[model samples]
Target: MTPIESQWIERLKQLPPKRVAEVLDFVAFLAAREERAAAPQRLSDGLARLVALALPAITEDEVEDEIQAARRERRASQQEA
Candidate 1:
């Protein structure tokens, strides 16, 4: 392990079990906070890549048509069953 990790381990070993548990909970909270902070950046990066692809946007009518087609397929499958 790294020196910092070793130091952390030594400090943790000196603490009571309850204190160690609290430290663990705090570390988890910090990690989750970091992930939450990164999520929006990740979403923005994904959207940028999608925009870079220059794909045509579907119209609302097209979306409705897809939904209707899916419903028709489901009905057909249910009838077959």
Candidate 2:
């Protein structure tokens, strides 16, 4: 690993388990976001085409509802497991 990455790993190791997990989760989120951001323009162009076709039926409230529903599903699954 790079020096900076090794130092950050050491620092994370010193944290409590819960805090370490939080940091790891945030790191994972950032990595996934970066991956999405780095996707090929061709994929994004296709998404824009779809959006253009569907934007009239896809409202902001529907997006929010879908997010909330996903969160609820995750919580329920966590509780059950």
Lowest lDDT sum, 10 consecutive residues, model 2, at 50-59
Put down candidate 2 lDDT per residue, 26-72, tens digits, no spaces.
Answer: 98999999888878776988999998887567689999999999999
Q: Rate the local accuracy (lDDT) of all candidates.
A: 1.00, 0.91
Least well predicted 10-residue stretch by lDDT in candidate 1: 48-57
What ranges in model 2 sit over 4 Å off?
Answer: 40-81
TM-score of each model, in listed order: 0.74, 0.44
- The per-prediction CA RMSD against the true structure, in angstroms, equals 3.2, 10.8
Give the candidate number with the greatest TM-score.
Answer: 1
Model 2 has a clash total of: 0
TM-score of candidate 2 against the unseen true structure: 0.44
